[model samples]
Target chain A: MATESGTSTRFRSQTADFDAETGLAVDAALAGLDALDIPTTQRRPLASRAWAATWPKIGALALFLLLWQLVVWSGWKPSYVLPGPGKALSEFGSRLGTSHFWDALARTLVRAVEGYALAVVIGVVVGVAVSRSTILRTAVGSFITALQTMPSIVWFPLAILLFKLSESAIMFVVVLGAAPSVANGVIYGVDYVPPLLVRVGRSMGASGFSLYRYVVAPAALPSVLAGLKQGWAFAWRSLMAGELLVIVPGHPSVGADLQNSRELLDTVGVMASMITIFVVGVVVDAAFNTADQRMRVRRGLVAEGTSAVRAARGSRGLGVAGGAVDPVGSSGDGTMPPPADPGAGGGDGGHSGGAG
Target chain B: MTAVRSDTAVRIDGVSRFFGSGAARVQALDNVSLDVRSGEFLCLLGASGCGKSTLLGLITGLDAPTTGTVDTTNRRAGMMFQDSALLPWLTAGGNIEVPLRLRGIRRGERRERVERLLAMVRLAGLADKRPHELSGGMRQRVSLARAFAQEADILCMDEPFGALDAMTRDLLHDELERIWRETGVTVIFVTHDVREAVRLGDRIVLLSSRPGRVAEVFDVDIERPRRIDSARVAELATVVTTRLREEVGRHGH
Candidate 1:
């Protein structure tokens, strides 16, 4: 027991006994240690990285198109009914140039923007408010989660009843579909923020709304962004459903055209419109994923910004925020400790490197 | 408020902190009291579950004692946690600038102050590096810089170097001591390492665990620039450790 005490308190730096040479040597060692801090990884060029990310997606598109063409030539269905990829591509191309198609596209795009904007405003306001109040959270937290899972199609009947067969009806459903996800995003984001970061902020003299703004809000951003992505998905689906159900006269919308093509049995037109929907879905989803990915990379939560880099690393998906992820990614600012592992912990690729 | 208390940076009077309520109530500190003199380096030393951190929280105003008072008067406190607690999203310079920005310091001034703090911590050129980009020691250095950015009179550190390797911890000890001496900022450093406490502290306050109470306080008469390996430091550390073990022994069945 006495020996254990002696060992525990053992000290090594005896500068009192150190002569001038030893001190200079120690200074060199210290300087060497300082210089040996891990080197920051170089960023790949933007054009190359962009190309790298684009290729696999392009390759997948080619593979999908080839299979679709093969299926048509295989006589699985008549050409008129199913249409070949080539035929559909040409039809979509032709539609792109036509005023009629552009008008329908504009109508669809306009509705999507308006509905989503409304949903975001409502969702963020409600989500932040509900998260802050214990009583409100207890009252409506679970309810929001329930709404997120509910098929937005379920809301169309009620929306129609409230707003009639107009743009408002479509917008009502879109906002309903999107808001819960956004609100839930903010709530969960706020709830999951690490208590340690909050304590640091408080000690730094952050209080009241500024604390919320600088610390809590920024810390909660990752989850909130996730929520917004989910919310957009819901809003898009609702708008599509609304466009089909509440077809207003004089409005040549994407959904209305889809309905018209099916009724007229203009199979090529139907395929083209279906292509439009699929393309829009892919594009919007890509937009959200890109935003999320860039944000994560910027915060250093993930290894690299480009999807190609992530794919190469065999990472399952964009990393979540925490010790496992990175605060350097999309969270509150602080001198947060990296995880235990050197390779995994530091903002980008950290190492507990250097001993001199 | 009185003239006699003018030199005291912090005065804790009969502070007893309890968690929970009723039968489940757990007392973390039992009538713990100490005075942190202005511009002095004080170490709160004890084993795990000793309420060393609880006491720190009280002094920092992050938590309050259930009984008694902790009076820091008008002086603000800046703290360093075990984890760097650096916002992962910001660069090292950005992290140091947090407190300054919180006080609504303008952007130009914030940048200039962050640069100075970074240089003070021996991290001059790496301000733009994010927390993850730097090593553990580097991150901790940034954390230290951020704490100092608050420009508070009292600095509270909760095992700031506990997770670091021996060499890094030793180096940081030198850095912290140099900074303390240069700035004359009163420090209330918490640590479990006996040698570490002896190496850095002006006086060591040892608390016994399980309803922590002050078992003893030792004045470290060792001269400035005392290394952890010094004979005098080792001697004091050994004496303190023996008493700490005795306190820990009381808990054993």
Candidate 2:
């Protein structure tokens, strides 16, 4: 018994030493790999990356302005009908200094935020509900798609009739237009969560709300975010349409200013208002794009560098490629393949066959 | 055969599972019964359609038997799948903490347990690394740590290392044997690899496919820390392979 105990102790210590040595070896190898000029796919500094991303967008805007100026010079229409780029820029510069323009912008933004928030809440609730129940899904799944396909303009007339040309009318149209898309996003996202993950969660004793909260929600996040982005675009469009159709007495909006400019034949003001709306849309979309990019980066779904760097890494095959590695034990010595009778077997035969 | 010994971690009595309905109904398990003894590493060996994973599902309570009863004596079983199935959004440490959090373990205690489990899996100081950042072997080690975190008496592993390379699999076998010996957890491991069964199992239960039923049970009686490539493992694996081939041949008609 004394000899046995001593032997066991010695064996235990030996194994511990072996493990520590392996750890050190792995660390050293990793350090070596880092030190080597393997041309790491490290991203550029944030400032440079931002500059790289922004310059093209600025160039596109300048090109668009130049094209407009050229179109005016060619007399595509009279300057009164299609104002020159200079006339529009001057009008925009003048509008930028006015408190009225700022107020109008703020009101439009507030209304968009309010309507979009309402749509998001409704969309998520409906989406989760529909995804969870086959009955609900069957009843309204196609109906939601149909609603999304219906133009936001179609809802404005009904909303105006219902709310009598108030701010609520605009909000109602916006919500109707955006909510369906958001709900569909949630449904699609929830539907696409891998069955393996769901089984894993269930095996871990998670059920009902806990399962949805912990497993389903996180897994479905990318899809949900995509849906939210689409919903915001719909909401913005619906809000603009509503503002043009129904002028709320207290709500000074960009759409109202556009209408006023059109009525007074101040074509440059109309163009400036249109530009302001376009810029606002682009800015909001940029915010959503940034959020999406951040999520993708966190998940390692997207490379951490500019496209040029990614392309370089791809060509050189220097970066860590996606996909699970081949089995470490595989010696290329062919083992007996799994039995090929599908009717009599589980589905893992193909998986093991490929590995072998 | 032993009248459901008190030490049995899992008891499946005359259980049969059938999938689909009417014309499509396929019998996956046919009147199969097994009693996994506590603290024994038992391997369920079978061909592809032999209901190995299905039996594991029943044992883990992920699925119920169409007939008969699967009794676990209210003991929770932690299961590891072929795929790591670690939550992609979580860090390695965060993944390990999942079951503990599910069990309502306090944050401080959970963190401590996560550290200890990671160390046990030889993945120390990798708590904050995301799943994608880790290699396949490392990810699986994190998964093993997560399975251990459930603190359950029984561990059900369905080809957990089947996807790994041979070298990694061998290393993990040593790691698993070590942990199993230390923890004394009743492990019901399912695998098709004959050598793997010989290397790890205290006793191996072989199953025939096409309405999977028990073909034979062999007590390895081999000493601990058996190497997969060792002569003893190879000899035993040859015998098991002969029987497995015979079982497959019977279905050839």
Candidate 3:
């Protein structure tokens, strides 16, 4: 009996220790948070995080440019075959100043956006349709996987035959390449969603559309976003491939420019065209990366340093609310133990605790 | 077989659940009969594949017993699981409001009730916080709050706190005891934890593996807010552990 009381007393003091450690951690975190500048209503971390995220990519770009300049100066290949960073930049600027270059760039940009947007819309719709139904998921899922595995360039010949080598034909190829990726993404996202989450939704009486909206869709967002990123890569690559193969008269898309440069053996223009495509791909990838990081940060999955602080704040809030009824001194009934582990008493700590 | 009293909230009579057919056929639950009293905290203790969870699933209307009737008078029943199961996308308050919303509670009233329950779980300020924002213990608390908010007469938990660490599980025990006392709701909790069964249950029912059937049932005379190291809890825990060990031992033999 005396030992039991001693254990309770020790437990109470341990609770106090936890609260104190939490409080100290929170104070330090709040101090660190002073640097974070997270807005009260803001879903995302402060501007500093965004700035930090961009800096590395910017540094990498600078490094790449430096390396390219070095390679050019070293005569790694002939000057025309491999232009220096300075020459490329000058050529890019010269192209930028011309109406012809602008027209070509504009046409390519429009096509890329059109194809990408079409893929996203069709992909998401078809993906969701396929994922939600077992029959569709089973029947078309294999086909979608097959399409995704096959190279986009393979579809260029088929696309030319289908649309008679027109701009619309190129868009069709891009859609074919990207839609499978998007659909597959949605399928995988829905598949991977934590079963606990689905059960929770059911317990809450959410089923059918309400359940999907409230639980499934949001839970699958990160994976769906990943699929969207993959889809974008496919769309961009397919568009470039289609453009190179299908030479349209009186129009100057990047793919067409590449073909023209190659025909004339203007290796500089071919390299320039390739560089433009690479830069665009890099920029799009960076944008998606930023979005993914922001989502994770908002969910508190990343940035573990702030966890104790947030938890401490929650405890403080609890303490303040309970104070009116129980008062501060009586709050030591040891009922609240500063957010300790709920599954601790189970023999093993490795039980399935949360959602997928 | 002991005759079940009429005051039973749950009565499983002559239930036999079989999986597969022919040579592969397996009887998950064979000729099981049990009575769970109204407002009683009954823990269904069993090993993996002992059909404890399958039994709970049948009771919750998620599955059907192949050869028996599960009668609960159509009372609103809520089920919790080993996982907190709180939606990562939903805030604690939002999760709690789900059952209420489903029952067609007015938006204002749902919000008010969710607010009250959040405070009850001591998660008042964290109403706007998502599940991912919560710690493991906090998430389970939110889950418990959500389960209670369902306003069900019978709450079925499948090792609800099984994933938590020792300290948080103990604290939740206190919290659950407080809630159970205040609500007087009937609870059918399932777990493999011997001590947890002793700590929370009014009656502990141990089921044997391979064609699961009731091995033993012990009535715990422990009072509310029972401490982990309480003599009564330890004593009952010892009795149940011994019975469970013997049951498991018989299988190995």
Best by TM-score: 1
Tell me the RMSD of model 3 versus the true structure: 12.9
Q: Write the per-residue lDDT of candidate 3 for residues B58-131, one digit (tens) a residue.
A: 88777789998998755667888777766544677887877777778899998888888887666677788766
What is residue A296's positional error in candidate 3, in angstroms? 2.6
- TM-scores for chain B, in order? 0.97, 0.97, 0.94
User: lDDT for each of the candidates?
Assistant: 0.77, 0.77, 0.70
Candidate topping DockQ? 1
Fnat, 2 decimals, each candidate:
0.35, 0.22, 0.19
TM-score of chain B for predicted candidate 2: 0.97
| Local error of candidate 1 at residue B56 (angstroms) | 0.9
- Proportion of true inter-chain contacts also present in candidate 3: 0.19
What is the docking quality class of candidate 3? incorrect
When 2 and 3 are scored with DockQ, the better candidate is: 2
Alpha-carbon error at A130 in model 2, in Å?
0.9
Q: What is the clash tally of candidate 2?
A: 11
lDDT of 1 by residue, A32-93 (tens): 66667654555667786676667767778899999998899899898889898888889999
Per-prediction CA RMSD (Å):
9.1, 9.7, 12.9
Candidate 1 CAPRI grade:
acceptable
